[model samples]
Structures are given as structure tokens and as C-alpha cells.
Target: MQVELGQKIIDKIKADSLSPKPRWHFLVREWLVWMMGALALIVGAASVSVMRYLAENSSWAVQAPYGQTFAGWLLLSLPYFWLFLLGLFLWLFYYNLKHTKRGYRYPMIYVAGIALFGSILLGLAFYTLGVGSAIDGVLGRKAPLYAHVFNPHIDFWSAPEEGRLAGLVVAHVEGEDTFRLIDRKRGEWIVTYNPRDDIFVVVGQPLRAMGTISGEQSFEAVRIMRMRPGREYFQRFGPTVISVSGSGMHRNK
Candidate 1:
């Protein structure tokens, strides 16, 4: 019985070797999976780039009157839809990577780690290549609806009365609390600091002010802070400026 079984195995191997093999299908499938992973990585990287661009250009810091802690503003203005898309791509990459030839030999953690690491590395490359920016510009010009859907600055200046305004300090109004501010919307406004608060004002600085909008293009600042690009929102607020003087800086409020 053992000899017969051995003979059968040998016969089976010979038969398989002689048969017309469609094993090319396996190779094709493997390449297809790899392509899917590559595509996912590309898209994930693009989404990241667009998200960074939005954060850099966002005026959310200064547009809401109800004071937003950095954390609150981040929660409100984050490009969540793009982030969701990025997550979806990463998931697809993982799924595809897991199905490739010999992929099952690895543990799930290893599979996931490779996918994540590869995607991140590819993402950084895409960002440095400016692929994201190019894609963003194209989408904005060619697909208005799509661009609007993903646009990060849609509601940056939505409300004024709540002491939110984002803009560059163009000029200090001659040693006064008032400064000329060109807001994100290209609207100019007069911003006055509260007399009791001490803050340094700098020309050409990107800034956000929280206080009250008294009239058209006029704002009374409750708090002022320099705005930075690509910084994460934190729960803690920075120290408020106390005063600015040609003689020196003062922090006593």
C-alpha cells in the first residue's frame, strides 16, 4: 500500500508537470495586488499633502468669535474627509499586501507594519515631490464641486461677532492699540487690543485675534497670538501678550 501511494504521488507530479499550466494567473494576481498597494500609497500621500496645505492656509484661528482653544479649532477645522480617505487607502494597502504571494507567512502585525511603513515612506516622497500641491491646484481649477467639497477654507471667516479674525498685521496704527489687518478673505479691518492686555504686535506676522467684532471691518481683540503653519492644536493656550513698546517688551497685565 505504501509503494502504491508513492507511485501515485510520482504520477501526480508528472501529470502536473506535463499539464498546460495557467500558473501565470497567480503571477498576474500578485502583480495586480502590488499595483493596488502602490495606488493606495499614492492617494494616501496626496491626501496628506492637501491636508497640510489647508492647515497652512486656514484662517480658522482668527475667524470664529467664540474663542477656540487650539484644540477646539483643530477639532472644528480639520480636513477630516481627506483624512478618512487616507485611512481608507492605508486599509486597502494592508488588504492587498496581505494577499500577495508568501504574504501569509508573516504575522498580521508584520504585514500591517510593512504596509504602514511603506505607505508613510511613499507619502513623504509624494509630499516632497509636490505631487499633492499639483493635484490640489488641478482639482481646484478643473473640478469646482469636488474642490469645494474638500476645500479646507470654506468657513474660516464664517462668523465675526465672536472675536475671531485671521490675517496679517500690515501696520501698527502709530503707537496705538489699533492695527491694520488684512484678513484671509482679503477684507481689511482695524484691530484694537484691549488696554488691559499686554501683547507685542509685529508687522507681516500671521495672527489670530479673539474678542468681538464691533462693526464692519473692525475688531476689538480680547487675545492675540502669532499663528504658525502646520502646528498641531494643543489643549493649553499660549501666554497672552501684555504690551509692546519701542523701549522694551512688558508682560505685566
Candidate 2:
């Protein structure tokens, strides 16, 4: 009687084990693929919109205000986001091949291919913009310079009550190494050097400053474009002045 009871218990355990269990792995894999695909579609749409807006607006610089709109965000997020999706897809594909008997590897590969293609395209788009310049600056290929300069005459005591005062660097400040530009009418405006490209000027040969200005300051030239380093040529229409203030300078330690 005890032996029969033991056999009965074993049979029950086997039956329970043979009962179908939920395929949690398959469900998770499907969910991940769906989420990644949705993100890719959204980013793709945003990229198209930004590209169109930029094309229509000729004055829109890569560092312009509207540059960070939805389109810009999409371009910036695309590569990394898609690469993440690709990794997920690859993992799911491998898991399905190993554990599940389903022939879903091909579908996973297809999804990964789409993600890879999107990442490459978005990366290319980003590089075409000022991203390349930023990378160059990071690698020390280009020296950083203050984009805007303030006139030297304007004193902070009697600076403009409203509106921005900015100019190009006429000389470097002795102690601070700051660029000195004169807002001849207002006085002198001093802008400190910024390290990051985000708030700072774009990285290039001589560097350019593009930002807004407000408050009182001295500035002879409203804006100076692309002032070359160690050169004294002023008002030659060399580069277009971007803005009136050093508000665009960004510094990150």
C-alpha cells in the first residue's frame, strides 16, 4: 500500500510538469521588438520633419535656436536608440534559436537589419551637421575660441538697460584669458571662453560665436563673423556675425 501511494504521487507530479506553461520568454521578446519598432518609426518621422524645416529656412544655422526642435532631437537620439534595439533583437533571436523550437530567427534578423540601417542613416545625418566639428574639437584637432566679443568701452555700471551687447574679440584678457570685444557705443564687453559646444560657439578654424545678448555693455560692432585668431582684420565681411551676446558660450569642466 505504501509503494502504490508513492507511485501515484510520482504520476501526479509528471502530469503537472507536462501541463503547458506560459511562454514568458516568447512574450517578452515580442514586446521588446514591438517597442523598438515603434521608437524607430517615431524617430524617422521626426528626422524627416526637421530636414524639411531646415531646407525651407536658409538662415537656419545648425546652432540656431530652432535647431533643437523635434527634428534635432530625433537625429541626436537615432543612432544610440536604434543600436539598442538591434542588440535586443539579436539577443531574442539567439534565445529563440536555442530554447524555443520556433523558426523566428529570420524575423528577428530582419528587425535587426532595419534597426542597423536606421542607425547608420541617422549617424550620417548627424555627422553632416555640426557634429563633425564638435568631434574635431573634442579630439584636439581644433582649438576652442570665444565666438562673440564685447566692446571694451561699455562699463557694467552704465550698460544697456535692455537688449544684448556683444562684439568680436579684439584682444585676449591678460589674467583671465578671456576674449575682449568692444561694444563701442555701450562700452567694453568681455566674454569668457566656453569649453562645450552646446552653449559655446561652434568648433572650427578660428571659431565663431552665435548667441543672444541682453543688458548693458559696450560694443562697436553689433556682431563679428569668424574673426581669425592672431589677425587684426576687422569689418571685412569675412564671416557673418551670429548674435549680440555671449549667451551661447557653454562651459563644462
Compose the digit string of candidate 1's lDDT tens values, residues 141-215.
355444236654444532455446666666564456787676645677888896544354666555667778888
Residue-wise C-alpha lDDT for candidate 2, range 195-236, written one tens digit per residue: 333222232113233443433442222333342221121222
The best candidate by TM-score is 1
Regions of model 1 farther than 4 Å from truth:
1-19, 58-66, 144-148, 163-253
Count backbone overlaps in model 1.
Answer: 11
Models 1 onward score TM values of 0.55, 0.25
Give residue 196's error in model 1 in angstroms. Answer: 23
The per-candidate count of clashes, in order, stands at 11, 32
Position 37, candidate 1: lDDT: 83
